[model samples]
Target chain A: MTFVLGIDGGGTSCRAALATADGAILGRAKAGAANIRSDLTGARTNIVEAARQAFLAAGEDPDLIPQTPAVLGLAGANVGTYKQQLEAILPFSRSSVETDAEIALEGAVGSGDGAMAILGTGTAYMVRKNGKSRPIGGWGFQVGDQGSGARIGRDLLEQTLLAYDGVREPSPLTAEMMGVFRNNPQDVVEFTTNAKPGDFGGFAPKVFDYAAKGDAVATWIVDKAVADVEASLGVLGLEAGDPLCLLGGLAPLYAPRLSERHRALLKTPLDDALGGAVRMAVRMFAAPVEAAR
Target chain B: MTFVLGIDGGGTSCRAALATADGAILGRAKAGAANIRSDLTGARTNIVEAARQAFLAAGEDPDLIPQTPAVLGLAGANVGTYKQQLEAILPFSRSSVETDAEIALEGAVGSGDGAMAILGTGTAYMVRKNGKSRPIGGWGFQVGDQGSGARIGRDLLEQTLLAYDGVREPSPLTAEMMGVFRNNPQDVVEFTTNAKPGDFGGFAPKVFDYAAKGDAVATWIVDKAVADVEASLGVLGLEAGDPLCLLGGLAPLYAPRLSERHRALLKTPLDDALGGAVRMAVRMFAAPVEAAR
Candidate 1:
């Protein structure tokens, strides 16, 4: 009964799962953001707590559990610099820490040879061919990340402000945004200041909701976002018939907004990133030669 | 002695001048924004006071000034509605109230048939043909004030916030904006809230400043702004030899940034909008037959 663990660590929260070599999920755990390089002590405590909770839920004694191979997909771990810090407290004998994007790509294609896009609080695109990976877009929220939810939200917010200032004409979308901010100018300031990139990205759904209700601005925003994302795909040299997988909270919401040309490239994965992580863990022991690379 | 008063009212201050039939200045006054519709009553009073001071400076009694024919070119008084409001307060027996754009256009071209563009806190374009007028742009601050100072300011502010949210990498421009905000997050709220559209527009010069100092982001912003403004010229169906005049505070700063295509259409005007107002006023009385139309 060989066991393996898979973890997906993000900016907002973390998810961990225990599975078998054959891909059966035995248990799962969830925790808050646990990036140690960003803040070591806090991340260590969060991981320990989440693991304990998962062990209790799985009806296993934490001390009696045997150490095994694990693969942790983490946001903000794109560079190799954070590996040493992660190795200090994480409990796997053979552990691999890679960007969350890599896990998403593997999960989407099962065995690479395709592309996966993550569109959460932020956005990134990853491609894998023959076990080697390449990234196209995912420069974060600053210079680019045009199609991400955060970008959409920021655009909407700016449009709303422009309307308020009478620099632009009022739009139906402005009314909806005002409603969301409770018609208080100060609340707008508060909302923007405290809003994480993903928090703004979360507003992507609201745009769709308004578009459905006949908001021209909302529709324009969604259309522009779709175009931007599609352009990213084109930049990656994605063929017309190539398979592409979408991941992240906003992916499902944005799926319908893609143009017909882009729609043809869509492929829903049978296994998600967590499943890919577990598979990677199992491969560590079963196929050591392949794992070593 | 016959007297003609020309006034130029803007957001920050107002200027009024008493000029003779020839192009000689007799006296001048400074006031503030009197576009009561925009909610700056105090500013309007300042303008009136400035005009009074101008009359005093001209060695004329303010109370006896009612006989002088005056023409005032004010900000925010576009065509249709606000023109009526301006007609009531100005002393000209047959005064025409128009956006500062018209005055700037007149100032740039004198009495010649030509086109002038105003790119201050807002933006507008006007053409004069046979002493009659046609306007091509200046749709307010919202949908299409492209290349205006306000748009540049808004873009910089948006980019700054995006950088702070960690959605994008830090750029030198972002660092400059951060320094402007004093590293205090709340400054974003204050600067944006307290800022007028023109104030943001005023920041457009700073972008030029940074670009001159070799900042890529600032240079990019300037390039994009010039492109946008130049494209707007096409809306008027201007020809290669058309007399195009550039006005407004940013016009001088952005002159070098204009594309050669737009530059080829350029014709330097002899006077500004205030001078145009004086020209219009003088023409109104000088040619009674045309004034009736």
Candidate 2:
């Protein structure tokens, strides 16, 4: 009857799964953003609330959250003091914090040797070999995060400005983007003044859609993004036929555009990162608790 | 003699010169940044402080500030409410505010038809014809500022990251930049998190210096910047042999690199923007206030 919890937290929302100690799925729940680095207190509150909601969804007592062991896969936990800070404040009987990418690697390939690149609003690459995680470029939107949705969208805006200034030939894509800002470069400038990475990422789907329709500017942007991803994969030492997963929102779009060698390495993930967190919780705390008997 | 004041206010500091009813310079003084858009209150305080200091430097009473007619050329005044806000409360008998570029145009080519390009931490363009000032692309670092020092320095960082990731071939320029951040991409990433445009602008000199020594990467970056500046000038409808002045801190570096068409238009500024402001003050307010009437 022992219970465990797995949590996947991102910049927008958090998801939690209630499971048996042996990793049987019970129920799932979702809550608000749990971006630890930006809003630790808010993340803590939402994580606990998600766990409570998960228990209730499983037709169990919300009170059981205190007894359940947990493994949390969270955005922003990998790079800063947020990991230690989160670990110390978690409500579970026993808990551990791992990067959203680390758990993604576990779910995408396995607990063994493999690699995964999560390309959503931002990008992060993780390689797990001999059970050690080697991370590359998740440096947020201000710098790093090449091939990310935000980066692609930002490139679109920069190109749009160039086209507006007649420095570059305008395409339908730039024309459409300018239209979104009411055909005013000043409006575009004002929008970027306070734009988060996610705000910029909102334009990424348009870039991809336009590229599919053979728009020249869109094609150019996508071509560069694909090359950047390929280079990052190459730099991460991803070999031919090594298990790799293109994870996150942009995964499906980027997966096909990658080179044949990289395409050959792509494998369907067994489960999403939430499942991986539950599996980890089962292995780390549940098994130890069981072994004591 | 009725005293007048000319003030040049920028993001870094404010400079003021005291003069007689005419445009002759007396003594000059400086204070902290008077960037009104970012810091309205601070700019107001510093503007008055610089004016007071100018009076003191000219061996006049600091209280003479209230009697002095003033014209200020200020950064961040053109695109926002800062100009109007500044005028409503300036501690002078009469005051007027204009764009730093406008005053620079006045200084470089006088009150006649002319154009000026300012290349510094950020870039701005002003074309004064038919007694009206036309400004283009002073839209801050997050968006516009195409040929700016900040943009050049930021390009260097992006190229350095690409080189580090093996996406681009490495060179001595990239090597030197990475060395500055202790050869760790993470260190470079962290530095950019809080870096101001000027902080990034700090690295622009190395880019120009390396271009002189034939660094391929530096040359590529500089060439692109030159093209952008050229394109902007063309967009501004700059004609052959039109009175144009290239102003600001990076002007000397960018001067020789520009196209011959642009070079032919380049003329040495008659005086700095501060002098332009003083000349304006003498014209606008000093003539009316003068006892010679």
Candidate 3:
């Protein structure tokens, strides 16, 4: 019997699912990172490995893989001409590629119209209206991704330094953050000299934790972050009737802190990114009744 | 016949001055970057090479180097144990090392008690009062260094991305910045993935130029940057009697934009950093009358 394959490839990891044409999932598998920008060779390898694992887990004939149709929602696909290149080389009989945000929107809304904001180590905003989708942020950490966990963590570090300089009042949160770098502003400075977004993101949970405990500085940072999220949602024009889902690691932390206006429209995703890819696969390859007969 | 050496080492370049015990500069020389944090080996080599150049320029006997005292005002000397390490290996009879800001302060204020803010690719504020000195900010781009050129340029890129997303109105400056990255937010993202503070700083001049032309976004950014500078000065507690000087690459651009309160306190530098270093060298090795006899 024929089946379809769905893959969600991201910076940190890749996941694959094997499903029937009716959208019933058969098997799922996961592999290492597939960030097409930094490690194209590694990403291509991981994507195929994930698909192979999914096929094996489904207990399908190995020969059937050559004929399986696949759809991939991948990071780094939005920027370059590599999508067609990756498609041309895949083992599947047919394949299509879309951005990770598009698949996330598909999985969250399930063919419906809505918006989703991912608030993890990075940030990306997507709005799907009347079958067309537009992305707002997710430009990456340096230039965009405002109010993301990485940005929040960076802000925390900055506040810690300000407190060190006596420019700002020291708080328990800032003290603790400085303590991690040995209570030495110099060490903190050294650490940041070569820091990446994920490295900075390591402090995000502390911000949320301190905010929960009513730490004034932490509360201020969280408030600013939530305000940035609201601004993106406003730019996306989230209406009273529109559903908005928050996704990614920091989403849950930010959920309760969001304003009542957003809380009212906030939604839980119906399916995950892999499920969305599976649905996309079905859309791409589900046979007509006459063809099936 | 005795001579003194003064060296000013920074991330970009190193300068040296050879002067008499009375602090009359005899010669000056320059060398490549000498930041201790990122390039310890290079810093050591550059420091010695600069001293050699100064000595040669001054027509001093190279063989008398071991008897000639030296003072260094070096960047990256603030945070590490390298000061003692560097001192232990110098070729001079006596060598003293201080932070670059300290030298700049020495250079800017001479023997007087006062304050100065260096607003270049990074920012640092120093106040010397009654034989004591204190520093504020200059923690580096990832943490502090607010109102710095690097921070300003990064802010420009961020605003450009915001305009691209339609979250903010696009201005000519932001448009030009995006144009540099080929109008691709992804391209901008990719460029920042590996950009250093200096790379970001390269765009700061554009921000100032646009602000001069009354570009709304550029004006807003410049105003906010100047405000941050003012806040830092306030934190430094510039007294009515205190002499303040603005130094560094962006200082001239920011000098006119400063609030009247700051402009009123601002004064001209007494000398360059090398002059400060030479004065310091004289102080470090001024012979007692008994020793002189």
Candidate 4:
């Protein structure tokens, strides 16, 4: 009757699930941000709190979180010693920490070999082949995230400044951006100075919308985004028929724009990342290792 | 017996010079950062401190800063209400706040109509024509500063990640960056997360060095930087023989790369920014404005 716990934590929120050892979900709950790299102690607290809430919702004592073996998919797990540092402080009977992208790939392609790209505010890729996992390009906004919504939005701002400088001809997209900023490049600069990746990602929709209408600047930006994504896919060694799923907030928008060759690899995800975490938890703690999908 | 003061303040340090009414520098001094936008109170403190030191060095009473009129070229003066705000809070009997680029332009072209670009960790342009000054692309690191050392280093990081992912072929520049980061993209990501523009700009010399040796990636990056700079110059409406000066830490590296048209316009600056400020201070407060040349 052992129950497994699965937690998915990100920069904004932490979610948890209580499920049977064989992977039947019983209850769910959520808590605050659990970005270990940014806030290790706080992330530990949030992870435990979310697990406690999930247990309570499952009609079990919250104190049982300490007895439950758990799997977690968390943001900032791949960089530095944050993962090991986090694992050491957890109260769960057994704890395993993996990047959010790893769980998402497992969720999308289900226990089999495949690849997935999370094209949200930031971009990260996860590939599983022959039971081995590899990660690419979750480098954050300062340097990486090439085909991400944040990158696209940043490109929009860059082009807007160029048009303002008469370095590039103004298009409808740039004109609208200028209007929003009150035709003040300083205002734009100020806005971006403290903008998080999500803040910049807010403008991605406008870029995609304008590109749909043939706005020259928007089209150029979108074209670059698509090219970058396709190029990353090539680097992943994904073939035309390989199982691939585009996850994250911008996935739907980018799906159709992928080159025809890579586009054929897209498939509906079998489960979301949390579900995958629960599935992994069950296998890691209860089921025989060979029984995993 | 009238004396004037000139101050140049930036993110790194604040410099001041004391001069007679005829624009002869009597003494110079330096203090800490006086970036008015990021820290008004601190900037005010540093500005006054620098002025005090300059006056003391000039064998005058430090308290006379309250009696002297000054023209200041500051890093953050161009953004928001910082200029006016700083002007109102100063101890000086009269103080004029101007962007650093303004002083640099005056320093280079000497009281006449012309243009200057400061190509340092950041890029900014200032044009003075018929006694009116216009600024372009001082939008800061996050949104503007195209063709800057900061931007060039950022481009190198971006390309390095691509090469690591196999999306781009490795070149000497990329390989060297990878080696520096110990062949770990995560290390690169971590290094960049908290990196300032100046931090990224630290790598600019390596880029130029590699470009000089014909590294494919470095050459491509430098070409883009040059094109962006040339484009901004074109937008400034400089003629083939306009009085143009390239200033700042990276100026020497970029000078040789300018197109023949812009190269023809390059001229040695008569003085640096602090001297330009002193000249302006004398003209504005002690000497006849028309006496400036």
What's model 4's lDDT at A186?
A: 76
Tens digits of per-residue lDDT for model 2, A200-252: 89999999999999999999999999988888888777666679988889999
- Of the candidates shown, which would achieve the greatest TM-score relative to the real structure? 3
Can you give the DockQ of every candidate in the order shown? 0.05, 0.38, 0.84, 0.67
Model 3 regions more than 4 Å off: A38-42, A287-293, B37-42, B287-293
**Which stretch of 10 consecutive residues in model 4 chain A shows the poorest summed lDDT?**
A284-293
Evaluate model 3 with DockQ and give the value.
0.84
Q: Residues A134-190, candidate 3: write the lDDT tens digits.
A: 999998778789889899999999999988888888899998888898988888877
Per-residue lDDT over B1-293 for candidate 2, one digit per residue giving the tens place of the 0 to 100 score: 37889999988899999998877788899999998888888999999999888888888898878877888998757665778888998888888998787778888888778788889988878887678877777777876788798989888988898787676899999999889988878788888888999998998988999999999899988998888788778777777667888888999999998888888888899888888998888878866656566
Candidates in order have lDDT scores of 0.70, 0.86, 0.87, 0.88
**TM-scores of the models, in the order given:** 0.55, 0.80, 0.95, 0.90
What is candidate 3's local distance difference test score? 0.87
> What lDDT score is found at residue A124 in candidate 1?
75
lDDT (Cα, tens digit) per residue for candidate 1, span A220-287: 78788887777666655567656788888878877887777667888997577777776666665435
Pairs that collide in candidate 2 are none
Could you tell me which 10 consecutive residues in candidate 3 chain A have the lowest summed lDDT? Answer: A283-292
Question: Against the hidden true structure, what lDDT does model 4 obtain?
Answer: 0.88
Predicted candidate 4 versus true structure: per-residue lDDT over A201-289, tens digit per residue: 99999999999999999999999999888888877777666799999898999999998877888999999999989988887787873
- Quality of candidate 1 docking, DockQ: 0.05
Clash count for each candidate, listed in order shown: 21, 0, 0, 0
